[model samples]
Target chain A: MTPSTDAPHSCTRSEDELWASLGSPPDAHELQCLTCQEQRRRLAPLAQAAQEWKTGTDPEESLLEGILGRVMHGIRTEIRRGTLFTLTVTPLGPLRISSYLLLEAIRDAVDSIEHVELRTHKIIPHADDAGPISLAVSLAMQAGQDGTEVAEETRRTIAARFAERIGMPIGTINVTVEDVFQ
Target chain B: MSGPEKPDQQQLGNLVARAQSGDPRAFEKILTYHQRGLLRFCTSMLVVPGDAEDVLQEVYLTAWRQLSTLHAPEALGTWLYRIARHRCIDHLRKRTPQPRDLQGPESLAGDIAASDDRSGENPESNAETNAAMTDLRRFVHELPANQRECWVLKEIHDLSYADISAIVSEPIATVRGRISRARTTLAERMRPWK
Candidate 1:
């Protein structure tokens, strides 16, 4: 039977055959196929360039640490203008849900105080929506002076909002006084 | 196949979320978790370590500003990897060729621009080596941009074909084919080395 170009290569033979054709040399098929032969002809310089792009640990650790520390410090300094117990919220995180509800609660918590700032941080995942949800949130606050009196008032207002506004159950709504920048 | 507990990815997702929520400590944790690996990846894709460092910092800043835009939380590693690869491509494009002058044989830094040969058994034989490299780059680069996309995503980031296809917006078969072809092209170029 005359060999046909259209004949499908056998599965058992194809992978090794193709990889071999490329890896080592042009066998009968590759030697004959113009595309494969061309590729075979051109492999040297690139392999050389790729090797030149070597990875080395010659990088300075201080360079990375310095940049990160500098940025973090700058952000912290600016944030302190408001509150201390700052939390960053992950998207779709429990603290995110709770913080939004808390904000709405405070939004309704009697207009005694003027301005407020809240932030959530640190996430711990919860399998069944437990206390933490793989994320930990820190709440940074910039709020008016209110001791136990305001804290309780804030809680009640937030709880009411959570019940009314957020249909889903929320995790923790940690509250902390970041700053009282007068 | 992701099992129920994608524990590693899950943990990373939580850390990112916390950092986005403005938790400094959580952000710190995220850095600690991925920093070394990220650096290594950047170093490999970019020719110079300096460019890698600069790009790595840019990635974090971009991530911080746009953390909320991460649609799927567990894919943070993959997302950062994508950013890293794009930045490398940008770096590659901006590079200007320097006049070739042979630095003495003793200098290890020669490896950076030797262009002489990947394995410089003979530096004078560079023309053949450079031609092969150029051709390899062309053939691999010629792949449908999507195939090239998949191949690079897989090769550079160490992402699986499935992950590569997901990132490149292609079917897994396409990803596999691209990768196979990429390897085939590279292998053909480096047959002597093999």
Candidate 2:
């Protein structure tokens, strides 16, 4: 007796095609094919192994912690080498602050505000070698806070902090609500 | 088991912007979030834990220095993966070509055993699972480097085909094909366990 061409045991799809098909909906040819079914059964363990590998915790968490510390140290040193801006002109010379310091000040100012978290900030110094600067900050507010009122308060708080802490006048303060957190 | 949840794109973008503007804390947050997946990719590609650790450190440092070069802040995840891929390739090139003595079979087995205990499986079943996992890791390690990288990025890291393509600098079709070839090889090799 000859085997029927459509028989489940007689399907001839390549293993590559079968594996690819597993990623998508089973085609009609795959629906009734014993060869495909067997292949899928054989492949199930491999898929499970891959999933386990993905979700497994690193065996050497201590090593990763060490690496993180070193990486952050390198980053902090590199940040200190970044561009500097003039905070004010003192009698000695220009009282310049590194970009890192400026960012820390802005972070501290925003941290003091209730319901407003600073996400990012850009400090734009006057191009003509002046003292006044523009500040652009993106903030995330606590859920249920009034956005307009919070934004206005943030702008005023940042300006005041810059004037009081850094002794520099802020020309314009732009506050954007980029996210809301519960 | 599932990995930690990734920050949404907007939050990640904000983190990237903050890092670019010299915020160490923000950059540290980004590093803490991605370090595990990046380390896994590097380990799979290099097949050695020490080399993977070194590559991961370089990847994060390079990312920090070049943060300003990344214009699309939302693409930070793929961008870091791309950096890791390049660094892994360079590390691989610097070393003499030879069969790597892959580490972690015993440790991985231990991990599996612990997981099995949590799931209330017997020691007999735990041993079988451990053996199967060890075999699968060896099979994955033996694949060609390109196929291994693409396969690890897609399967282990859960990256999309497009994201894998961008990291490996291959077209999406090529990424899919590489991943397909990898799956075929792994399935065939693990058929005995079934």
Model 1 lDDT tens row, A1-182: 21112232432234323433443645776656665444444544344544432221324454767766766676555444532222234576524343333332334432334433333433333454433322222222344556455445545555555467653344554455443433
- DockQ (0 to 1) for model 1: 0.12
Segments in model 2 whose C-alpha atoms lie over 4 Å from true places: A1-32, A87-95, A115-119, A126-133, A138-151, A168-182, B1-3, B98-124
Tell me the tens digit of each residue's lDDT in model 2 across B42-139: 87888766998899899988888888899997678899999998999999889886544455345645544543444332224766767667667777
Q: Residue A17 deviation, candidate 2, in Å?
A: 6.8
TM-score evaluated only on chain B, model 2 = 0.84
Give the Cα error of residue B181 in candidate 1, in Å: 3.0
Expressed as tens digits, the lDDT of each residue in A64-119 for candidate 2 is 77998988988788778888888778899888878777778898888899877677
Tell me the lDDT of model 2 at B61: 87
Calculate DockQ per candidate and list them: 0.12, 0.35
Clashes of each: 43, 0
Residue B73 lDDT in model 1?
A: 69
Model 1 has fnat of: 0.18
Error of 1 at A109 (Å): 22
